[model samples]
Target: MAEKVRVGVLISGRGSNFVALEEWNRRGDRAYEIALVASNDPDARGLMAAKIFGLRIWAKSHKGMERAAFDMLMDAELRRHNVQVLALAGYMRLLSPEFIRAWEGRILNIHPSLLPAYKGLDTHRRAIEAGESFAGCSVHVVTEELDDGPVLAQAKLRIRPNETPEILAQRVLKEEHRIYPEALDTFCRTLRGEAQPTISSDLKK
Candidate 1:
């Protein structure tokens, strides 16, 4: 059997995506294991879920810390946990260039908008305002520039008429859950010298 890579997931909110990824990891034999769940918010509900899943969890609030300093702390902890890959699952903080460079190609993130589209927040609202026919999500490498990275996978959902951001988010989130796990697994396997397709897309009509 192929050895599983150690993946540390970072999250800031309720951790819906973290749950999705963990569930995917548990379903079968795969290329990666969610070794740690780290967050800037100690109160993140996802931590509780991670506990239930028996995943190593770490949290340190970033309220007063410098951005670069916090990223350094994260790096130390992830290294301590023997993490090989970092997955950003709603991790809100923008990493410093130092941290990005340290991780280099070993980090992956799932962004709400099909990347290179809405790089920042309010993606669903922005897409609706722009009259976009479809709103989507992307799993990509985490580069220094926000949401600017080589996309590994994407899932596009058709924008419904007059869809609210909340409703649209619910739809797009389902796809995020679907693609992120597959994308992360493929990336991990590729790094391990396996011949795997690195990019995939689901065009949801």
Candidate 2:
């Protein structure tokens, strides 16, 4: 049997996507194993969820710290666990450029909107206000540019009539849970020198 890829997840709030990844690992996927769950917010509910699953957890307050310094702390924690792949699951902090250069293609983030569309927060609201017919979640390689990385996979849903942002968020989150694991699986396979799956759309021109 091949060794499982060591994955570290950085989260800020409820880790529904983290739970999905954990569930996938538990189902004998053998593609990756979550080695660490770290959060900047010590009170993040995701930490408690991770604890319930018996996964190693790290929590530190990033209040009033330099970006590089804070990211270095994250880097140290991930390295301490020998993590090979990092996933940002609802982690709100923008990673410093140094951190991005160090990790390069090894880091992944799941965003609540299609790329080149809504890059920052309030994605659902923006999409709804723009009268978009579809809103989805995107799993992409993390780059220095916020949500500007190459998209690996996306799961889209049609906008329901009169759908508010909160309602749309709830719907899109389910797709996030589904596609994130799929993207990670493909990413791990690529890391192992295997043939990459064709799940990704080309980088937005």
Best by TM-score: 1
Lowest-scoring 10 consecutive residues by lDDT in candidate 2?
A: 196-205
lDDT of 1 by residue, 86-191 (tens): 9999898888999999999899999999778998999999999999999899999988888988999999889988789999999999999999998888888897
Report the C-alpha lDDT of model 2 over 1-205, residue by residue, as the tens digit: 6677899999999988999989877876657889999999999999999999999999999999999999999999999999999999989888999999999989999999887789899999999999998888889888888888788898778888999999899888888887888789878877787648565532210
- CA-lDDT, candidates in order: 0.91, 0.87
In candidate 1, which residue ranges exceed 4 Å CA deviation? none
Which pairs of residues collide in model 2? Answer: none
Number of colliding residue pairs in model 1: 0
Candidate 2, residue 42: the lDDT equals 98
